[model samples]
Target: SLEVPFPSSREAVIALRSLSPDREPRKGGISKQLTVSGSTLSWSADEARILRVSVNSFLDHLSLVLETMEMFGSPVSQ
Candidate 1:
């Protein structure tokens, strides 16, 4: 099981929505589950590699979103 905490509930929901549909049909006994509550995301998978890949993909998208938000969502104080 993997649990990730987001900076805000809205960001967590965005991450959840962005990652929820990433599951692909597997031929083996591999299975994956994901859930979101408040500002956290929890994931469970049968295989380590599958989980790693899924997490990597999710992080990639999450990074993009966070960067975008930083770019446009608010003015950064310097």
Candidate 2:
């Protein structure tokens, strides 16, 4: 399994809620059951601790980011 750490977290892929049938993306799980080991991500979430973030868990983070952006304004650079 591959493990990559996101220092800036700028490359995080956020998912859109509304989508057409043909444009709809597949959920992150098929590979989990098929492969012996899945990819792991290490992001600064909990006290900047490097933890085991599965594909599914990482996707959830993306989805949450998309949803929050839809509601709140974008983050400004300081």
Global lDDT of each candidate: 0.73, 0.36
Clashing pairs in 1: none
Q: Please give the range of 10 consecutive residues that has the lowest summed lDDT in model 2.
A: 29-38
Off by over 4 Å in 2: 1-53
Give me the runs in candidate 1 sitting further than 4 Å from their true place. Answer: 28-30, 74-78
- List clash counts for every candidate, in order: 0, 0
Residue-wise lDDT of candidate 2 within 1-78, one digit each (tens)? 333432233322222222112232336522221111123232322322222434455556555655675687544555
C-alpha RMSD of each candidate structure in angstroms:
5.3, 13.2
How does residue 64 of candidate 1 score in lDDT? Answer: 83
For candidate 1, lDDT tens digit of each residue in 1-78? 788887777777766777667567778754887778887877888677777766787667767866776777653343
